[model samples]
Target: VQPVLEDLDPALEEAAQSLGGSDWTIFTKVILPLLTPALLAGLSLSFARSLGEFGAIIFIAGNQPMSTEITALLIFIRLEEYDYQAAAAIASVLLLAAFTMLAVTNWLQSRALRYTVKG
Candidate 1:
């Protein structure tokens, strides 16, 4: 994210300033618009990572077999019990849901890029 913003041409902001645009205007009109793709990609990846976060959650929420736990943790519990069929079923469902969300986010990101003026 830092690299993406840093790599933008400083000349663009200078040009906007030369045209009487203020800092806010330069950011909203020039910088923010161009950062859309990176922002969306970041959000998409973060969401995907969050969906797979069993380890972190496990520290907070101790394992209780067949009881309340996130899907990822449940899948792990099933595996520990040698229940491959249950784990596989759970994993397949999770994958389908995650894939649907990612697909939608990517589609929206592509659509947004269509209206953006890229360099």
Candidate 2:
């Protein structure tokens, strides 16, 4: 988010202003599109982090085996029970989910910025 914000081309707004764009027009037409990728990336990363945070969640929602189980907690339980297959499956699902989110985030970002040349 910081990099995107810091590296944003001031010329975008300047050009809009020179062309008689209003403040709302410049922000909605120029700045918003540039910031979309950053916002999506942040959301994807935050969700991934929260998904893997089993320890913090465990304290809040006791370690009941069946309900309210986060993927990490479920994997831990399966491991303790020596259910290697189940543990592996659960871990794979979690990994796949995180990977999908990150991949989609990157793809969306690139697609959104496709017309932009590096400044």
Candidate 3:
């Protein structure tokens, strides 16, 4: 992220200069606001991916019941134990969580769009 920001700084400076204004004013007034949505979207996607991650976490987690177990790993464990009810419950919870996150992301994107249009 730091490297990308460093690379972008030069381009952003060029853009602001092209607008015929001071660098500080252009950055604070224009670029910062415009970048908010992209930053939020990246964060939201990363968070969602982390929530669903199973394989990496499985090796690190102790897999104790209701302890270090993540929802996805819990589902796998339930399947192995032949506990369909518990597996289904955990799956439902995961589904709900994913949906909630998606909804929030959508809302944030919409808000960004509105800001871009109105600002």
Candidate 4:
């Protein structure tokens, strides 16, 4: 996010200011639009990372059999119990969810990029 902010052309804000745009107007009409793609990318990446988070949670919050609601943890428990079929089913569900999220993010990114200048 910092890098993206720094990479933005100062001339955009300058031009907006010269055109009598207020600071808030310049931000909403100029900066936010430019930053939207990076914001979406950051959010989606963090969400994907959190979805796969298991080891840290297990280590910090110990496993309470059948009580945890986290899918990754649930799959781990099933695997430990030698219930391969159950683990596979749970894994398939997780995979489907992750793929769905990926698809949505891609769709949103494409839509956002539609108005972006190629240069």
Candidate 5:
């Protein structure tokens, strides 16, 4: 994240410069506003990825029930324990959460795009 932001800083500065006025003004007025979509998208993607993260989390989570266990790990544990219904419930919840987050991000991105186009 730091590296990506650092790389983007120069380009953002250049864009601000092209827009006219001082660097600070350009950064505050133009560059920051323009970065909103990218920032949100990055955040949403990272969150979704984290929610679905199983392998790495399971290794460190200890797989305790209702403790450090993530939804994915819970599902795996349920399956291993032969609790098919519990596994299915956990899977359904995970799917619903993922889909809801994705839908929200899509909606926000669409609204941002519309505003950008109108502006």
Candidate 6:
């Protein structure tokens, strides 16, 4: 994210300001549009990371059966109980969800790129 922000041309903001744009306007019209790809990338990576944060969540939230159950923990519990079919099904669902999220991210990134300034 730092690299992405650094890569953006400072002159773009200066130009916007010279054109009588306010700080908010320069950010929204110039900076924000240029940072779209970085924002989307960060969002996607964080989402994927969050999905796999089973250990942290388990330690912090504790496995409270139905009350505070997470899919990953549920899959592990099913496996421990020798329910291979249930564990496999739950794992499959998680994989599908992750793939779906990636697909949507890619689509949005492509659309955003179309509006980005091409050098």
Q: CA lDDT of each candidate?
A: 0.84, 0.86, 0.74, 0.85, 0.72, 0.87
Worst 10 residues of 2 by lDDT: 110-119
Q: For every model shown, what is its TM-score relative to the native structure? A: 0.71, 0.77, 0.66, 0.83, 0.66, 0.89
**What's the distance in Å from true for residue 39, model 6?**
1.2
Model 3: per-residue lDDT, tens digit, 9-119?
A: 455567768879697797676666666677777888798888779878878876677788887887888999999999999889888887888798788877766644231
- Clash number for every model? 0, 0, 0, 0, 0, 0
lDDT of 5 by residue, 25-103 (tens): 9766655655657777898889878877888876876767678877777777789999999999888887888888889
Q: Write the per-residue lDDT of candidate 2 for residues 45-106, one digit (tens) a residue.
A: 79978986988889999887778788888888889999999999998988898889888889
The top-ranked prediction according to TM-score is 6
Candidate 1: segments with Cα more than 4 A from true spot: 64-68, 78-93, 115-119
The C-alpha RMSD of each candidate to the native structure, in angstroms, is 3.1, 2.4, 4.8, 2.0, 4.5, 1.4
Tell me which residue pairs clash in candidate 6: none
> What are the per-residue Cα lDDT tens digits for candidate 1 across 1-119?
67778888888889999999999999998888778788888988898888878877778767666565889888877899999999999999999998898888889888767756666
Question: How do the residues 18-114 of candidate 6 rate in per-residue lDDT, one tens digit apiece?
Answer: 9999999998888887788888899998998887778888888987978888888898899999999999999999999999988988998888888
In terms of lDDT, the poorest run of 10 residues in model 5 is 110-119
Error of 2 at 74 (Å): 0.4
Model 3, residue 93: C-alpha shift (Å): 1.5
**Regions of candidate 5 where Cα sits further than 4 Å from its true position:** 1-29, 117-119
User: Model 4 TM-score?
Assistant: 0.83
| Candidate ranking (lDDT, best to worst) | 6, 2, 4, 1, 3, 5
